[model samples]
Target: MANREYLKLDRVKGDLIVLEGVEGVAYGEILEITLDNGLKRDGKVVTVDGNRVIAQVFQGTQGISTSNASVKFAGKPLEIALSRDILGRSFNGIGKPYDGAGPIYCEKKYNVNGRPVNPVSREYPRNYLETGISAIDSLMTLIRGQKLPIFSGNGLSHNELAAQIVRQASVKGEDSENFAVVFAAMGVKHDDADFFRKSFEGSGVIQRVVMYVNLADDPVIERITTPRCAMTAAEYLAYEEGMHVLVILTDMTSYAEALREISSSREEVPSRKGYPGYLYSDLATIYERAGMIRGKAGSVTLLPILTMPNDDITHPIPDLSGYITEGQIVLSRDLQQKNIYPPINVLPSLSRLMKDGIGEGFTRDDHDEVASQLFSSYSRVQDVRSLAQIIGEDDLSEIDRKFLAFGVAFEKQFLSQKTDEKRTIEETLDIAWDILGILPPEELERLSPQMMEKYYTQR
Candidate 1:
């Protein structure tokens, strides 16, 4: 049968065009809506009831009248053309080329809704991916195929941290040659998008970075597809081209908000905080995409950044995300007020997969012990600071005073660094040792005798 064009629409409401008496319409199938003015817009089938269908127009439903618009079903789902050439390009939220470069040569096209990696086919994630940041490399190490989210807050420096990771991230050994980055920015301002492009270009890493940007002024519907387009590109590069891909999605809160808006437009039942009921499973579809497949020579690592609403980690967005991802890197408002760059609060930040990634072969032999000692020693510093607040610091015990000094040095020396500065794993470990040296050798209970003999020095 020929593609039948329905000449009448049942209703038009807030980006949704509903049609009645529609036949053979499958969910997720593409649609072409032509208005009386002869202008056409793209849409996809979102809901299908008996002889009634609801489709979301990618562009807003403005200027579309129910009697004047026509709908034609396209027999395929939304897809983006993929190839090796997309590595250095930039695209809009819906995978259309945003850069001046022409359209990509379509070697193959991939559906944006990617299939989840099979549990049985997934290889245990191993080996560390270095971000060249001391706080992360020494304490919360990001494994190659793990999904580690950065939990930040409004007005913090998460954008700068994300750019720094894009510039300095690398795979160890000869595999470094195959490392690439996929950066997707959703609901960012025009200036923020410019900063990312310029930063990547200035660092001379743009050639290895693929960017998908969705500006704040763009359609909210496009924001919903931005990360999916990014993931499709990353999946192509990693699984098809045999390259290690690091996918960085910034401001996932914007994505979640867009999801909520669309859900409200559909008049769907709301869950916690007025978000859609399927928020957890919706997030899992994206977060669960990162992994290593058995017999495949590549991996996809995800680092999604979301700003907690009012610094409330219990907010539905961050709360559900924490349940899906491997671990989190929580940024601190207190540290940012002190002018720290990354502002990562080490106490709550953790990487559950760090144990298998760091060792004698991956980063360094003392990585595990150094990380443990840093965590243990820092916890004591917090206690000492609390005690000093009640009584005068001058009246504190000798060890307590030393802990105060150690805390100060730890934040300024270890956590704070230039935005452009890059440190190797070796240099990061050395700095950790230097900070640990502030305390008496006998107080270092986390470190083994052998590790202490080589790295520990009393200052």
Candidate 2:
């Protein structure tokens, strides 16, 4: 036990090491292993069963011989340094500085594996966080502590939409100084990373953003740590420093894939689509991290973006994520084909927390009604659209023709928005009423008489 420093690696398989005769090794403890080539590689203990310890080497075991390896446990789990200086900086998945600013000057270090928010201290999310996109702000509203994910497909503009939200998202009427963004991108392509960097910088929000990126070609094990590191930073900023943090993790599908790869490496049994059965609890570790502590001045709101495989929302990644998060914003391939800029299919997308976040004090007084009426009207628009496809539009009744016209205007005006456009909640609500006015007043069943009198106008 005293000579655990020179323990031999009993087995090596694809970035994983199996060693026996290790005493007192704990799970998640960092290890510095010296390879036979005199090169040092970092590893972390993933399992500890009596005297048999399994560890994952961060650097692949390319030139290592299992007979002559030296392992030293760091005596603690993986941790990251935290400071106010973390803002306006970029780092790789392991929290190493990548922005060329050198190492962060800080005295505080935190384990990347964060604990879930305690239920007693949890406050229900009620404050509105405006992203300035009409489709999101006016209908699928994002609250301060809610976890809402955006479900997209290949070649969709989810990246652009995510960038726009990071740029325009804010706590309405609150000063920008109190808000911050922690963006964690998992296994993204180089071009997508560059787009996010340029978009944040160009929008002048880069100063308040802390970005964590894991490129597609990087080590697959690092992908498993990226979001956890980002969430740890968000917790430090929000709970410790009283700064409202918006954490956006893009391409979560890649993360889940990484989990599957590691599970295969460990020879674990596969579940649906070769994913592990614990996928739900694994996702919960990330999604459940978002919330407002009862007495804290700051909150962590999550907006995770995951691309659906081949546009299938029923895929394991999205299916499990939908069960964990508050709600989802589903992007439509049909709308994308139509050349819509932000191609959000509003009918199927929803925010379950929309009710508690909007209304008199949080947003406009008529926000709830306006959003309901818009949802109802737009849903009917779908029915009319399907019917029009069966029986030609010219053969419809006069009122049906008016409904068809309203549907067209709704998609063109209310649903479609520019990438650079920033619409306030009030403006978004007004635009909804304006679009609803295209139909006769009787068609607006969801709107109250008071709202109709205030916003609705006779043709």
Candidate 3:
């Protein structure tokens, strides 16, 4: 006969949940909690074997014993923190305030493990999100209520790029619509967290910015929920408060690794490359949350960052991410090695929504033609580069040599920018003209004569 003993889990110390008769018991889905001394707790389902279940506690592992503690399962995963008050507030992964402001005076919360939204109810993403960066705006335009990822490698400046987007992204002024930023970083270093905090404050967007951070030193379990909590807050702000939101999740790779670790700890069967079997579905839950809901006044836009191992675009992280996201902004290690600050590889970077977001009224009449011309010119420059290497520079034709120079100038001028540099749409367009001036006016058949006069420089 199997003996059953009821156990009481009293507290959570860091990641370890303190309970009776179970030490080091892994916690799963966090259920509802009633706080002691007004300090709330979240529950998780730690183990399930042959109908026997065990859970670990969150918050602290102090003062819990067999006789005093009590627990009940709500038959669901941890409820997500979903409310309008989540913004401008900081929380650990388990939805506890690390900001020291105390418990949220809110009327509600929701399941953190989001339910699958009905596909038929999904609204098409039509609105535009204007990120001040020209390459992104002109080539890979970001649409409102879209999910995009920044595929970067080690030593890449994805953080700075993401920060720039958060600072600059807005909607067209015609409707006078504006958006808010919800930036969350998982498993980031202490200095990085401080940098982000200071960045939002210095930008004066801290009032509108909602930040959820799990430091590198924070328990891995926290990393798993940081982005989810951030999204939950974003959902509240956008869907509830009628605000457009740009949610930036830097280092999703860390989030994935954390999930894998938890899966291993729980002794779940691993799948591709030792990742959890449900990695795809788990990601879909988060990514699918960003979109326009039918009858909702606001939308959620997502930009997640994932660092590639050894600059491998084919790696599981970026590879799987590419399948899920609308498109990626690929950072170049070669460019970084060359001392390019931003290191954006424009050719490889793509914004799938570019076609829908850019047009005459949206940006300018020449936007499409200009972008195609730049793309064509840059791609051709690569051929010229290879030829230069083969035949030696002295053996190249005048035009071929000029094309090579243009490539170098384009990378250094357009792609590379100092971290502090901020350029408006007008400034970026003018600079494009300045660089295009090196090519003959006859070669620019993409633009009309009127455009040539208004935007082009006459030799």
Tens-digit lDDT track of model 3 for 1-459 = 112223454444434443444322233544433434444455566564554444545543355444454554454465555555566677777677788877776666766655566878778887678777767776677889889898888778888788777766777675334467888899899988888888777877676677888888776766777788878777877777888999999889999998887787666899877899888878888888888889888889999999987888887778878888899888888888899877778888887877876667676777776777788888889888888788899999877777777787778887667666766656666677777777778767677787787788843
Q: Return the candidate ranking by TM-score, descending.
A: 1, 2, 3
Q: Tell me the spans in candidate 1 whose CA falls farther than 4 Å from its real position.
A: none
All candidates: CA RMSD (Å): 1.1, 1.5, 4.4
Regions of model 2 farther than 4 Å from truth:
1-3, 36-38
* lDDT measured at residue 144 in model 3 versus the true structure, 0 to 100: 90
> TM-scores of the models, in the given order?
0.98, 0.97, 0.87
User: 1-459, model 2: which lDDT tens digit per residue?
Assistant: 423585578998888999887887788888898877678988877778888888888877778777778888888888999999999999998888998999987876899999877899999989889999999898899999899999999899999998999999888665457999999999999998999999999989999999999999888888999999999999999999998899999889999999999888878899999999999999999889999998888899999999999999899999989998888999999999988878999888999999998999989899998888888887887888888899988888888888888888878888898899999988888888787878888888888899888878755
Model 3 misses residue 424 by how many Å? 2.7
Candidate 2 colliding pairs: none
Best by TM-score: 1
lDDT tens digits by residue: candidate 1, 1-459: 116899999899888988888888788788898998899999888788878888889887889988988888887788999898888899999899989999988756889989977899999999899999999988999999999999999999999999999999999888889999999999999999999999999999999999999999888878888999999898888898899999999989999999999889878999999999998998898888888999888899999999999999999999999999999999999999999888999999999999999979989999999999989999999999999999989999999999999999999999999999999999999999998889998889999999999888888
Worst-scoring 10-residue span by lDDT in model 2: 1-10
lDDT of 2: 0.88
Better of 1 and 2 by TM-score: 1
Model 1 is weakest, by summed lDDT over 10 consecutive residues, at: 1-10
